[model samples]
Target: MFKRVLIANRGEIAVRIIRACRNLGISPVAVYSEVDAKALHVRLADEAVLLGPPAPGESYLDIERLIDAAKQTGCEAVHPGYGFLAERAAFARAVIEAGLTWVGPPPEVIDLLGDKVRSRIAMEKAGVPVTPGFSTEEPDMETFEREAVKIGFPLLIKAAAGGGGKGMRVVNELKGVREAVEGAMREAQGAFGDSRVFIEKWVQKPRHVEFQIFADTHGNIVHLFERECSIQRRHQKVVEETPSVAVTPELRKQMGDAAVATARASGYVNAGTVEFLLDKDGQFYFLEVNTRIQVEHPVTEEVVGVDLVAEQFRIAAGEKLSWTQEELSQRGHAIEARIYAEDPAGGFLPAAGPLLYLEEPRGPGIRVDSGVVQGVDVPIHYDPIMAKVIAYGPDRETATARMIKALEHYVALGVPTTASFLRDVLASKPFRDGETQTDFIELHFKEWKGETDQDRQIALVAAAILPNGVKTLAQNGGEQQSWRQPTPWETLGSWRIGGNS
Candidate 1:
């Protein structure tokens, strides 16, 4: 077992992994940029290291600096909570070379799965179902055109280097192919530093479903079921729930099997997620494999009663999975709503300032994972996510209802959040019916202008009539306005949203 582990990321995920390490009696180490000097994870860790400046390129993403922190701190292992260098193959290999245990899969597996084209090829060789796609070291115009004709129009050009909707394009017509190809190549080069692109038959309105699978050094693997991540905005998942309403029992079996196959093919170890795009007809295609824990891992943990971070520690320590596939069963539904500091009304532009008031929901089945506290400044230097609100229950209906209630009660001060918009989503009929997909946000904002008018108006009216300090007058003994109810704030505006008083 690792006596000490360094968390190389920030925000809620860092705090999350720290708690898991503590539960296992492991000393937790945290590294932070200047902006996160007082961040929750830094405060919670048993030991802390200052990496560098606030910019990720100099701090969190600096591989050499992170390795130095590990060596100087005498950490036996490093647990990358996710993001940063979590999926970077070189980072894993470096830890191993430094005589430290890497609490993730082997470097070779990361390299193979990190490359989209190689991952697809590997899955295919392992008899896993994959989407029809073309690969070329360098594609020629004639070869591209011939392949397009055979695969049909409406194809996607994906970057071979990384996968995040970056360096990707969709061509709907023949005349658009050349332009789309050029644009995709340019974007791919800019984003991933890799100009290599490939063509694939694009599926419309695909539901994003992923299977969470864990493997151990003893050739043991188990699937922990699926997460319905179809509700997305700009390729970012806003709402994630387990027991995908779209997946039937039989389809679950098939996808689970395929996820296991993908893991086995990669010789995977530790926790990983296999993402798939499930078409309406119940057919699913392997999209890619996330080589580390996902942001939405909470939902899976809720329904399965498993602490994945703890499991990762056990697996990396050369222990086989204690539970088998048959013993794994998700008993209920879990829904998670991400709260970002970005404002949905202001074109989702990012917002940063000192947090004056921070009130998060708490109670049975409600979990709030946050990174900020009152007086801490929200910086524009990192991802805008402020916290995640997750709810679990015996079924989706109960979980969704609880999450919506939690979002309403939750409050933040310094910056605007997506809380209300998330509330609207939970109330929408389409979401209730579980009929969302990757394009849900486009579909959400298509009518967002007029649809949110009432909510906007109601919020305004409530504020005007019931400002924090505004009082409701009451008469005593037939006297007019004898007493009043006073609130903490008498003003209503951006400034009143936060204050120590």
Candidate 2:
């Protein structure tokens, strides 16, 4: 095992990696930008390094600076949690060349699976079921036109090099294929520096399901189970849960087998997620493989009782997988709701401001993984996610009820959040009945407006009465003094719909 590891990321994931390192008696080194000088991850780490300014190009995304930080801090490994350079093969290769263990799959494996077209070809040869698509390196409009006609209308032009809905477009008619392809290519180049795009058949109203798979250098691989990620907005998942109501025991076995096959075909090692789209007719097709730990990984861990981050370290240290496929079993239902600083009513547009007051829910079967603290500024420079609220229970109903209560009790003033929206989602009849398809939001909440009359009134009262003597909390201190004074907002007392004093 490595004596020390450098976490090459920020926000809640950085805090998560720090805790994992402490569990294994390894020192965690955190690198931060200028804006994050007082971030929670930096405070929790055993050591910290300043990369550069707030801009990612010179800070978090700068491969050279990251490698230098690892070397200077004498870190034996680097863990790229989730986003920003996590899937970049060049970054992984650079870490390995610097004689530091990269806590992920080999760079070659990342390179192969990072490209959608190449991964589809690999899965096809491995006998894995993939969605019908047309892809070629030849830049010919005639070829694309012929392929689009054969695939029919309502096909997708997707970026071959990246995911997360970037560089993706839907063409409903043959006449729009060329323009869509050009737009997709331009977006792909801007996002991933790769101009390659491909055509794929669009499956209507399919459920987005994914399997969490792990492998080691010792030729052992296993799938932990599946997560239902059908509740989404703009192609990004907002709610995720395990023990998908749609997957039966028989279907689970089939998808599990296919997920394992996907890892084997790519010579995968360490933690990775194999995504699939299940049609209404019960047939499943491969979506794509995420080469690093997913944002929704905690839901899988809560049910399966596995520390995926710890497993990543073990595998990177050349240790074989400790558990077999037969030994693993899903015990209960777990659901996660991502709390982003955005407005659900305004099309989920990102919002940034000071966190005047912050409170997290506490109880059995409830876990909050958060990055920001009260009295801190929410930067607009990066992902707006502030925390993730996860709930676990013996059954789906109990879990859903717990999640709704948690979101209701959670509060963050001075910025908008999706907490109330998520609470409504969990309480809705369609979600309760397990009708979570990819278009769940489009069908149920096309014009949804959050913030009830009472809630809005409370927010207004709280903001109006905030005194000028508001003092920011002390950095690296245990005790904090409340800056609020006597006001009518305080008369409303704690345990309101969205917050407490």
Spell out the clash pairs found in candidate 2. none
Model 2, position 180, has a per-residue lDDT of: 93
Show the lowest summed lDDT stretch of 10 residues, model 2.
492-501
Measured by TM-score, the strongest candidate is 2
Please provide, for model 1 over 321-375, each residue's C-alpha lDDT reduced to its tens digit, 9 standing for 90 to 100. Answer: 9799999888989999999888787677778876655788987789988877654
Candidate 2's displacement at residue 111, Å, is: 0.6
RMSD (CA, Å), each prediction: 8.3, 7.3
TM-score computed on alpha carbons, candidate 2 = 0.92
Query: Scored by Cα lDDT, where does model 2 land?
Result: 0.90
Number of residue pairs clashing in candidate 2, backbone atoms closer than 3 angstroms, sequence gap of 3 or more or interchain: 0
Give the whole-model CA lDDT for all candidates, comma-separated: 0.83, 0.90
